[model samples]
Target: MFDLFKEKLADAEQTVAFGSRLSGACESPVCIYLHGDLGAGKTTLTRGFIQGLGHKGNVKSPTYTLVEPYELADWQVYHFDLYRLGDPEELEFMGIRDYFSDTSHCLVEWPERGEGVLPPPDIDLTLSYAGEQRVIELQANTEAGLRVLNKL
Candidate 1:
C-alpha cells in the first residue's frame, strides 16, 4: 500500500523549493531514498531540505565522506551519498545502524549501492532530467511516508 506524487521542476530553484516543501512534512524519524543520475539535482534538493530544517551552513554532498551529519535545533539529519561506496558491507563497518535512530531523519543518495546494508526507506524520490528541466517522483512506502505525501 503506497502513494505516489509527481511534479515537474522548471529549474534548480524549483527543485530546491520542492525539497524545502518536503522538509516541512517530515517531523519524525524517516528514511528517504533519493535516486538520480550524476548532476540530477540530488544534492540541490538535499541542500534545500537541510536548510529548511534550520541548518545555517552549507549542505554539500558527502561523496567522499559517505555521510554528513547536521544537528539541528530539534532534529538530527543525516545526508548520505553512497555513490562512491565500494561495498555495501562498508556501511556495516561504519556503524550504519547508529545513523538511523528515533530522533534522526536520513536522506540517502544512491541507495541502491547500499541495498543490503541500509535500512528500508519510508519514501523513495527519483529525479530525472527533462531536457533543461527536471521531473521528480515521490513514492511513499510506509504510513509515515504516506502522511508526508498527504501533507504535500
Candidate 2:
C-alpha cells in the first residue's frame, strides 16, 4: 500500500534532518536496509535517526565491530555495518535472531554482504549523490513498512 518517497538533501545536515523525520515514522520490531556508497551519508542519516529517537549519545557506524547496540527508553536499536564481514555464516553463529526481537529495531548497511543470512528488510532506503548534494529514496516491502510509510 506504499509508494515511493524521495527527497533531495542539500548537505549532511539536511540528510540528518531528513533522517530525524524518518525516525518519527519508524516503529519497533522492524528492519531497515540502507544502500549507499562510501561517504554517501548512510551513517549520518542513522545518527540523526537514533538521536531523533531520544538517544542522547553518539551514533556511529559499527564498521569494525559489525554491529552496534543502543538501548533507548522504549526500544532496542541495532545498527549493523557488514562491510567487513568475512562470512555470512558469522551472523548465525552470533545468534542474529536474538538481536532482531519483537521489540528491537535494526538498521543494516551493506546488506548485500549478508545475503541469505540477514532477514529481509521491511523498508529499503537508498542514498545517492546528486551533484554536491544527496538524494534519498524510501520503499516499503511489507505491511509494517507500509505503516511506517503512512506515518511518513
Candidate 3:
C-alpha cells in the first residue's frame, strides 16, 4: 500500500532496507513512476533500491540531465528525472523507446512530464511530504506491479 511509503523512512538505513526488499521482489521488466514534490526522498529511496541491486555510486537526482541510467549486476535501473523537460515529445528525441525494448527496470521521477512518450508504468510511487516526514503511496498499475506489492 502507499501507506507504506507514508511510513517514516527515519534514516537512510531504513530507506535502504525497504529498497533492498523492493529490488529483490522485482521479477520482470518494470516501469515505476515516482510522484512527489521537490526534496521528497524519491532519490533517497532510489538510492536504496540501486544499492540493493548492487550499484555503487552517488544516486543523485537527474533533474537537469533528465535521466540517470545504471547497469548493475542484477538490474538495469534507469532513473529519469524529467523536471527539466519542456515537453513530453522530448522523450522521443532522447530515444526513450530504446529504453523499453527489453527486460530493464525503470524508475522514473516526474513521469507526468513525459506523458504519452513513455510506456505505462508497472507501479507508481507517489511521495508527499508531511513536514519532515515523507508519505509514499505505491500503486501497482500492472500485473508486474501487483506481483511486487503482493510479495511485499
Candidate 4:
C-alpha cells in the first residue's frame, strides 16, 4: 500500500527536526529520494538525518563528489547527489548496486538525473518554497516505505 504525509516547516530548524523524526522511524534498509530546488533545505534535512542516525560530524552535500559514505554504528548510510551527473551510465562505473545492500540506507538528491541507473526509492520526498517558509510532501511507494510512514 502507498501512503503519503505532508507538513509545513516554519524554518530550516524545523526541517532538520522533521528529518530527525523520520530517522527514528526508519529501521530497515530503504531508499529515499529527495526532490527540491536549490536552497530548498534538502541538504539541511539530510544533515539532521545523518546526525540523528548518530554521526557527530559534518553532513556536507555530495555535489562535487557525487556520493558521501557515512558509516554509523548500526547503519551504513550513503548520501548521493546526482545533480552534477552528465550521464546516468556513470552510476554503473561507480557500482551503484553495491550501495543498495540489505544493510545500507541510501538518500538520493536529484534522483531524476540518475533515472534508469538507480534503484527505485521506497520513499519520495519533495520540498518546495512556500513564501518565507517551506512545504514538504512525502510519499511511500513500497511496503518498507509504508512501514516507515506508519511509524511516523
Candidate 5:
C-alpha cells in the first residue's frame, strides 16, 4: 500500500508532524531506505525524524563521513549518506555491521551504493519534487514497516 504527503514547508516545525508520525511507530533496530533525486526533501524528512527522537542539534547528511550517529534517551539513530562511496564493499571495511547493533534505528540515503551490504529495509520512503511542492511516498517492506505506515 502507498500514501502520499504533499506540501512545502518553509521550516522544520511544519515538517515535524510527519517526522513524529514516523517516530511514533518506531521499534528497535529499524532500517528505512530513503530514495530521492537531488534537492528532494530526504534530508529534511530525516531531520524531522531526528527531532522526533529528541535530538535538538542540527541534522546534516553524512556525505563525506558516510555515517552520523545520534544517541537519545530512548533510541539510537544512524543517518547514512553513501553519495561519496565508490563501492559497497567499502562499507564492509568501515565495520558497518558493528554500527547496526540491536538497539538502533537506521536511515540510509543512496542505498543503491551499498546494496549488498545493507540490511533489508523495514520501511522505504521516496521523495520527489512535485512542482513547487514536495511529495513523499512511503511503503512498508516488512511487518514493522506496515505497522509504522498504519500509524501514519
Candidate 6:
C-alpha cells in the first residue's frame, strides 16, 4: 500500500516544525526526494530536519556545492540540491554513489534534475503554495518509507 500524509503549514516555522517531526521518525539509509518550486520552503524544511536529527550548526542549501554533509553521532546526513546541475552526468563525476550508504540519510531537492542518476526515493515529499501558506504531501514509495509514515 502507498502510505501517505498531508499537512497545511501556516508559515515557514510550521513547515519547519513538520519537517522536524518527519526527521524524528526517519531511520538511516533512507532517501527522501523533495519536490517544490522556488521559495517553497524546501531548504527551511531541510534545516529543521537536520537540526532535529541532532545537528547544531546552521543549515544551508547545497545549491552551489551540490551536497552538504552532516556527520552526526549515529547518522550521516547528506543534503543535496540539484537545481544548478547542468547535466545529470555531473552526478557520476561527483561520486554521488558514495553518498547514499546503508548508514546514511539523504534528502535531495530538485531530484528530477538528477533523474536517472539519483537513487530512488523511499519517501517523496511535495510542497505547494496554498495561497499565502503551504501544503505538504508525503508519499511513501518503499517499505522503509511506510515505516516512517507509520511512526509519524
Q: Candidate 1 on 29-103: residue-level lDDT in tens?
A: 889999999999999999989888989898898999999999998899999999999999999999999999999
* Residue-pair clashes per candidate: 0, 0, 4, 0, 0, 0
Per-prediction TM-score to the true structure, in the order listed: 0.98, 0.96, 0.89, 0.98, 0.89, 0.97
RMSD of each: 0.7, 1.2, 2.4, 0.8, 2.4, 0.9
Candidate 3 vs 5: which has more lDDT: 5
Clashing pairs in 2: none
lDDT of each: 0.94, 0.89, 0.80, 0.94, 0.81, 0.92
Residue-wise C-alpha lDDT for candidate 3, range 1-152, written one tens digit per residue: 33232355666567667777888888778888988888777888889888888887788888898888888875678989888899998899989988874568888988988988899888888877666666567888877788888777
Identify the runs in model 3 with alpha carbons over 4 angstroms from their true place: 1-6
Off by over 4 Å in 4: none
lDDT of 4: 0.94
Worst 10 residues of 5 by lDDT: 1-10
Give me candidate 2's TM-score against the actual structure: 0.96
In model 6, the worst 10-residue window by lDDT is 21-30
**Mind giving the per-residue lDDT tens digits that candidate 5 earns over 29-127?**
688899989877778888889888889999998989999999988888999999899999999999988777778889999999999999888888887
Model 3, global lDDT:
0.80
Better of 2 and 4 by lDDT: 4
* Candidate 4 residue-wise lDDT, 39-113, digit = tens: 999999999888899999999999999999999999999999999999999999999999999888899999999
Local accuracy of candidate 6 as per-residue lDDT tens digits, 1-152: 48799989999999889878989998657899999999999999999898998899999999999999999988899999999999999999999999999889999999999999998999999999999999999999999999998898
4 Cα displacement, candidate 1 (Å): 0.4
Count clashing residue pairs in model 5. 0
